[model samples]
Target: MPRLEPGQPAPAWNLPTADGGRLSLSDLAGRKVVVYVYPAAMTPGCTTQACDFRDNEAVFAQHGYAVVGVSPDPVEKLATFVEKESLTFPLVSDEGKEMLTAYGAYGEKQNYGRTVVGVIRSTFVLDEEGKVEVAKYNVRAKGHVASLAKQLGISL
Candidate 1:
C-alpha cells in the first residue's frame, strides 16, 4: 500500500490502549495528532523512540498536538512497555495490523541490507480536521521525535 499523502484524510482507527482504554481518530477530531507506528513493544529501538516522545510530551502539548504510538503488540505487552518506560502518551495495540496497513505503515522494507516484509517504521501528523499534514515512512527510531519537533517548528 502506498503511504498516505498530506491533505488526505487519515484512516479511522479505534484501538485498545495501554491504559485499558480505547482511542480513535474521531475522538481526536478537533486536535492535531501524531500517530507513530513501530514494529514492536519493549524492543531497544522502540523503547528509545517511545521514550523520546514521552520525554518531549510537554513540547508536543504546547504545540497543541497529541501523540500516540501504534504497534502489533497486544494490549498486555503495550501496557507493560508504557509502565516500564513511563510513557505519557497512549501506546495502541494493533494486533490485527488493520490500522497499520490502512496508514501504509506495514509492508516491505529494507532491514539490515535485506528486503523484508514487516512493520515499516512510519509517522503521520494529522491536522485539526483529521487530514494528514505530514507523512513519513521508513523513519529511524532514534531521534525521530526530535526531528519531528524541528519539522513542526517546536524549539528544542
Candidate 2:
C-alpha cells in the first residue's frame, strides 16, 4: 500500500456525507483539514474516535482546522452514527473504497497478530495548500484526536 507522506499533496475527493450533503476536498481549500479514516461507524473504537474529534472540534476550528471523517459505511449508517453520537463533523461514505485506497487507509493490516486485509485506521493533516502536514497510519482510536492536536501544536 502506498501511504501519503508529509509534504505530499492530498488526493482530491468528492464524497457523499451523512447529512445528505456532498463534501469535496477542494471545498475546504485554503484551510487546514484533518481527514481521519476508520474501519466502520458506530463500532466501539470508531465511536470513541469520532466522539473525540467531535468533542475537540472547537479547538480545531479555533486553530483554523476542519475535521472530516471517512469510512466505507453507507450514508444511512453514517447518518445514524452522527445522530447517535451527536457528531459535529462531517462523515463521508467511501463505499467504493477508492478514496480509502488512494490515502492508503485500505489494504493489508495486522489485526491481533494476524495479517488481514481491511481498513487501516489512519489520519492525515493537510496544510492550507492541500499538502499533507502529517500522516499517521495504524492509529489507536481512543485519545487519537488529543494526540493529533498536541502534535499539531494546538492547545487542548
Candidate 3:
C-alpha cells in the first residue's frame, strides 16, 4: 500500500453515510477534515475510538476540523453503529474497500504477531485545500482522539 504523506492530495471520495445521505470530499472542501478508518463497527476498539471522536466533536469543530469515520461495513451496519453510539459525525460505508485502499487504510499489517490483510486503523487530517496535513497508520483505538487533538495542537 502506498502510504499517504503530508502535502499529498487526499484521494477523492463520495460515499454513503449512516444518515442515508451521500457525502463527497468536495462537500467538506472549505474546511479541515479528519477522515479515520476502522476495521468494523460496533466492535470494542472501534466503538471506543468512535465515541472518543464523538465526545470530542466540539473540540474538533473549535479547531476548524470536521471528523468523519469510515469502515468496510455496509450502510445498514453503519447506520446501526451511529444510532447505538449517538454519533454526531458521519460514519461512511465503504463496502467495496475502494476508498480504504486508496487511502492506504486497507492493507497488510501485523496482527497478533502475524501478518494479515485488513483495515489499518488510520487517520488523515486534510487541510482546507484537501491536502493531507497529517497522516497516521496502525494507531491504537484507545485515546486516539486525545492524541489526535494534541497532534493538531487543540486543547482538550
Candidate 4:
C-alpha cells in the first residue's frame, strides 16, 4: 500500500486505547491530530519515541493537536507501557495492524542495512477536516517529536 499523502483524507480508525477507552478519528473531529505508529511497546526505540511525545504533549495540545500512538500490541501491554513510561497520551492497540496498513505504516523497510517486513515507524498529522497535513515514514525514534513539532511550527 502506498503511504498516505497530504490533502488525502486520513483513514478512519476506532481502536482500544491504553486508558480503557475507545478512540476514533470521529471522536477527534474538529481538531488537529498527531498519529504515530511504532513497532512495539516497551522496546527501547518505541519507549523513547513514546516518551518524546509524552514529554512534549503540552506543546502539541497548545497547538491544538492531539497525539495518539499505535502499535501491534495488546491493550494489556499498552496499558503497562503507558504506566511504566508515565505517558499521558492515548496509545491504541493495533494487534491486527489494520489501521497501520490503512495508513501505510506497516510494510517493507530497510533495517540495519537489511530488508525487513514490519511496522515502519511513521507519523501523520491530520487537519481539522481529517485530511492528512503531513505524512512521515521511516522516522527515527529519537528526536522525532521535536522534528515534528518544528514542522508544525510549534516552538517547543
Candidate 1 residue-pair clash tally: 0
Model 2 scores a C-alpha lDDT of: 0.96
lDDT of 1 by residue, 1-156 (tens): 778999999989999998999999999999999999999998999999999999999989999999999999999999899888889998899999999999999988898999998999999999999999999999999989999999999986
lDDT of 4: 0.94
Error of 1 at 81 (Å): 0.4
Per-residue lDDT of 41 in model 1: 94
Better-scoring candidate (TM-score), 1 or 2: 2
**Candidate 3 whole-model C-alpha lDDT, 0 to 1:** 0.95
- Go through the candidates in order and give each one's C-alpha lDDT: 0.93, 0.96, 0.95, 0.94
Question: lDDT tens string, model 4, 55-141?
Answer: 899989999999999999999999999999999999999889899999999888998899898999999999999999999999999
Model 2, 51-105: lDDT tens per residue?
9999999999999999999999999999999999999999999999999999999
Candidate 1: segments with Cα more than 4 A from true spot: none
What's the lDDT of the predicted structure labeled candidate 1? 0.93
Worst 10 residues of 3 by lDDT: 143-152
Question: How many angstroms is residue 104 displaced in model 2 relative to the true structure, after the best TM-score fit?
Answer: 0.7
Candidate 4 at residue 86, lDDT? 96
Tens digits of per-residue lDDT for model 3, 62-143: 9899999999999999999999999999989999999999999998999999999999999999999999999999999998
Give candidate 1's error at residue 18 in angstroms.
1.1
Instruction: Extract clashing residue pairs from model 3.
Output: none
